[model samples]
Target: MKQIINTKFAKNIFLSALALFSTVTIMAQEEDTSSKFSLSGSIDAYYRTTFKDGGDATTATPTSFANQTGFALGMANLIGTYEMGKTGVVVDLVFGPRGTEATFNNDILNGVINQAYAYWNVSDKTTLTVGRFNTWVGYEVIAPAANFNYSVSYLFSNGPFSHLGAKADFALSDDVSLMLAITNPWDTNDISASGTYAVGGQLGVYGQFLNAYYDGGGQGGLGFEIDYTGGFDISEDFFFGINAAYNSNSETDSGFYGAAIYPQFTTSESFAIGLRGEYFAATQDGFDDVPVTALTLTGSFTKENLILKPEIRLDSFGSDNEPFLNSNGEATNSLSSFALAAIYSF
Candidate 1:
């Protein structure tokens, strides 16, 4: 009886051990296949005032964001990301003035959906992405936290903001990469009324990119645009960036061309100063070319996840075109402004 009882006890122990090992192995496999989800975003606001003869706050800079007088809200950006093995998804949402302007072409969710895309890693050197994504043509993005200056430039304001379609990214070599995309016409977020589409390509060598875009020329199509965006680190504390683009519409015989340079100097880990000089021009079939020269100086201070930017900007347009008014409400060809912005990121 003692031998039989001891044998039963041993068998029970062996079964329990097996069960425990199986449970651990299952848990390890689950951990390896589990997906990762993350949330990140930013919020920003600014106070702006003009420095012209009339000190008119109404006639601020003609750019996209931070144009409202006195205190104004920039936007709240929320980005959610999910990653599992070789596949991942990103959903970026935004709210407020800046978001509204950036997504002006979105018909359904007007200012809410900034970017929603899914990507799959096809191989070690290639990836495929589908859905809507931010345009890869510009040096500066729509997010205020991503830009050194509180205000935007003409090139960014007029360029395509986002695209909806499919793209392939290829890593040609350690330093060379290529991207090709086909999408609905520029800024057509929901659907294309004209049933037209666009194609874009980008070649990257080192950190510079040569980007090109073309669409079927029609009433509302963006005919073609070629852009070059790049930056160089001059020293440990100084950096220089450049952006140049030419856009033309064959149907309308109208388009714009512009170039801008950014020079920044970091004083410390928390503070930096930057300058942007731009020359932009517009051409129409019958109208004379209208050109504008703009200069902006900005200082950035950072603490933790919060950033403070104080900026001064000046714009001078051609004498033939007076788009701004002075303190006396008279036509003028120049405008100057000052702004202080606060941005918090997480």
Candidate 2:
């Protein structure tokens, strides 16, 4: 019967994601038992083998990797954190199934708290937070030591992940920094969230640009961001600079985004390497007969906790378009896909 109501709606969204991790830390009353809580996440399981150059196998897009072969790929998170003193609470959830968790696979469970916010230090350049945050406008990172561009880019994970509501952080010194948010934009986590395409309110700014001396490392920081999304039927605005990006919409009357400045020279450390080259295109999404073009090249290998990634990609939108899978499953429509990744982190 519709798979028993989709397994009771995935067990009631996993018990409302465990009641949003204990309803505001037990309705806030305070207890500090030596202040300590630590749990972290990262693991994008890999093992893919597919080479479907077939003419037509059910005409692709069953989440297409074409003619779909075996040795699948899934699992993109591992998290948890809790700290005492200055108050702390975090519940990072990600369960992407491929091997276990009652098979029918894709072990879904991401964010009841991908990031749970709570911070306060009311002085020396203020700080405050409410719940669910993270959006510096993207160099590249959903959170993985602020990525240098490693499989998750197409305007930084399709632009927007975690921007719940209520935020404040300003440290206009020691290299200037200021953040402001009054969000609702993303998935909003049920509570009767309505008026959909997404735009309940969002605002942000992060500055760092001054002192220039080349060779990829020497006072290198320049960024600009702008976003005013309110799309339930279309009303979106976007901008980002330090590379380039621009957007406008009711389904794209414009689209220009950029990334192709390979860098990975972080100092005071052991070893690091980040190289990237990317391009994404769309102009006239109001539909002049649909068009989309994509290309990517990525690499990252860090020493510390260990991280390794390698990728290459390409895509085309029409002519019955089929090809685009690079998180190591390797597939490209115009032609290309090869990936190798390994991550061991704490």
Instruction: Tell me, by TM-score, which candidate is best.
Output: 1
For each candidate, how many residue pairs have backbone atoms clashing (under 3 Å)? Answer: 1, 6
Quantify all predictions' global Cα lDDT against the true fold. Answer: 0.84, 0.42
lDDT digits (tens) for residues 220-291 of candidate 2: 111122332111211122112233344333222443344434434433344444444445444454433323
lDDT for each residue of candidate 1 in 53-118, tens digit (9 for 90 to 100): 746734766778788978999999999998766667899999999998888835448679999987
Model 2, total clashes: 6
Model 2 spans with C-alpha error above 4 angstroms = 1-34, 39-82, 85-116, 119-132, 135-141, 144-150, 153-157, 161-164, 167-285, 288-290, 293-312, 317-339
Global Cα lDDT for candidate 2? 0.42
RMSD of 1: 15.8
lDDT of 2 at 165: 47
